[model samples]
Target chain A: MPLEAPVEVMLAASAGNVLVWVVWVVAALALLSSGIAVVLFTNPFYSALSLIGNLASLAVLYLLLSGEFVAGAQVIVYAGAIVIMFVFVLAYLGGRADAPWAGGPTLQAAAAVVAAAAIALEVIVVIALAAGDQLSDTAEVTGAFGSPAEIGDLFLSDHLLAFEATSIVLLVAAVGGVILGSAMPQRSKAGAD
Target chain B: MLGPGIAAYLILSVVLFATGAFGVLIRRSPLIILLALELMLNAGNLALIAFSRQLGNGDGQIFALTVMVVAAAEAVLGLGLIVAVSRKRVELDVDKLTTLSG
Candidate 1:
């Protein structure tokens, strides 16, 4: 009873409360704005940059979730490698900015909006229902939840097959990329010369 | 510390996912579409990590890592295909790709 009192008091402290709220608000805004920019920007390059910003903010959010390894991987893999690949393709396919949204099929757009809204409503209801629930004893969080060692143990023990299979898939993708890139007649001609 | 609760994280994930879906629906460029897809994937990752932390489980984080790898490979192949296709034709718009038309 005494330990619970102090724990609750600590969580209620003004400094920690304000700091968490501030970080959460800033990260959330950055995530939302960058996601919008990624979609709305006319230039592909700008969209790629916005996507990078979104990914970086998402990494920060992951850190807030106490997923340290996931945060790092998000920055390194998504922001660094994937964005670079996107930029490379954008640069290679030089062109004018895409045509302004001329309002594609109205039915498709309406369906998309309805589907997205339905999903959002469903999530909100689920969150409301789960708001009062607490983690089970077996799932009680420790400081090591996202530590590298914990992740490694999980990967090696439970996810070993998946981990190995991902390697194979990546290898195939790499070879496929090479074939697809070289298969272009223009690329082949340039290579021959 | 009074950290943001699971509901906050879930709300953010929902918004992000919705934005990505809207982007995919509204945008015409293939590159932009791909970027939107990435946004959706990241949103899913966020939800997974949030639940993982709530449950004190490492499995979700590992799964997110696997998702990232798969996403990377998908981006590589997708961009490669885009490059090859663009070389043959000038338009990179997705609507014009009616190759499957009967």
Candidate 2:
């Protein structure tokens, strides 16, 4: 509505929108670094670290996309909890260098290249679509969702089922991992004896 | 041209997703693969949120929230498996994990 008012008003609005674009650029750079990390690092530890950075960057990007609740959750769950779990497991497994890097034959490399090409093509399509006037919607992102009270309402009311499900899933996974990990030592000891 | 449109975000997400996919195909370490999987999932989440904002809907953000939880769960379970397997085998070579293949 405001953009349709007048030339001067539209110019003013566009000027104000520059702040959001600047943020977008910064977030994009962060995401880019994370992507490069994923490709270059063979070590799982380094990969995990890069993934953490990537997750944190994605969380900020989520904020820019107007998903404040998701953004905070991304940081807390992904960067905080899951990354810790990954690092712990990696340490227990004697780090990434000891793990196998080339598990398959030479064909896998070709496959990887093909897959990368396909992904690049998909991105090109998305870029073309975005350039056209196909998408017409509100760009306003709510800042209030990041507040405690509003977030609580959204968590309890709008997403109660999913929330409960996540807790249950995490509980199951924790117990299962422990059982599996603990059993290995005893099994190996029996074989040695 | 890339000021504030949905395409800029989409293109970026695609690159991120491609990198993750390439990592998945190239890397043999399950832990690294799992991390790559997380990257791919996050790329999808970015796309979803961007589209949701472009369409003025709350559902995309909601789905992205769910995906994050699932990704966490996946990482926990996945790493646990990696640790358990490594106790005896000592190394998790993708080629060596052929128990499933006939």
Candidate 3:
């Protein structure tokens, strides 16, 4: 009775509980389908578009979980910025790029399937075992839970070093990107000389 | 309070991670590989945020933000490398374009 109390109360108290369930179903379905589409589609452009769909669904799920800031970042950074970069490169590469599944599953592909399956099975079993009794009811979240202000405070206080390290990482990545982008042209120039 | 519980989210994360790994392995295009990598990273982010909600705190959210920045940087550098590779090589396949140097 005690175990079921919180869940039952949550269901009864919220009129929009059904809507949340529906939204979760829809977003989860979109996430899975678009994820599959991203992998299955041969055209990189379609794959990029599919990735965008996947990102959008993930953002919606983040909203359901009260991760408003993460939801916003998922939309902006992933769907907005990263997917755009993919499209630009796809445009540059054009349609002539070689497709992957040209003939059939090679030895490598078969091995990949096996490896992925084994890892997934092991992890899932652990989750099912450990998560059975503990996570039946959700945590009692505070008013400030998942708020940007709270998370920002954590960034500047608890995780300050990590935050600064991330900025340095971004700086390095930016420099790497610029140099890498120009690398080929400089090589060709050297060849000409 | 996603209705299906935290376990559902965890299962979903596993599936997404598996799909991404499969894509990364089978796909020949560098761009698709990068896309798959994004999926994998987002899979981790999903789990982190789900736990953040479950714990009633902002720790996981902060971690998720850090992940986003890293993912962005990774995508930028990866795309740049793809562009660099495309210029010299006629075939843009990862398998074919193996060697780093001439």
Per-residue lDDT of B12-60 in model 3, one digit per residue for the tens? 8888988899889988888889999999999999999888888777888
Candidate 3's DockQ: 0.76
Best by lDDT: 3
Better of 1 and 2 by lDDT: 1
Which CAPRI tier for candidate 2?
medium
In model 3 chain A, where is the ten-residue run with the lowest total lDDT?
Answer: A95-104
lDDT (Cα atoms) of all candidates against the true structure: 0.84, 0.76, 0.85
Kindly report which residue stretches of model 2 are placed more than 4 angstroms away from their true locations once superposed.
A1-15, A98-106, A123-133, A139-151, A185-193, B1-3
Give the CA lDDT, 0 to 100, for residue B66 in model 3. 92
Interface RMSD of 1: 2.3
Task: Residues A89-130, candidate 2: write the lDDT tens digits.
Answer: 777666747333355456777888798879889777766775
Cα error, residue A103 of model 2, in Å, equals 11
**Which window of ten consecutive residues has the lowest lDDT sum in model 1 chain A?**
A131-140
Q: Which ten residues in a row have the lowest lDDT in candidate 2 chain A?
A: A96-105
Against the true structure, candidate 3 reaches a TM-score of 0.89
**1 or 2, which is superior by TM-score?**
1
Candidate 3 per-residue lDDT, tens place, A1-193, comes to 6899998887775747777888889999999899988987878888999999999999998988899888997898888888998888888778454466777878988888898788789888887787767767778876677777877888889999999999999999999999988755556678867
Error of 2 at A78 (Å): 1.2
Per-residue error at A70 for model 3, in Å?
Answer: 0.7
Name the top TM-score candidate.
Answer: 3
Q: What is the TM-score of chain B in candidate 2?
A: 0.93
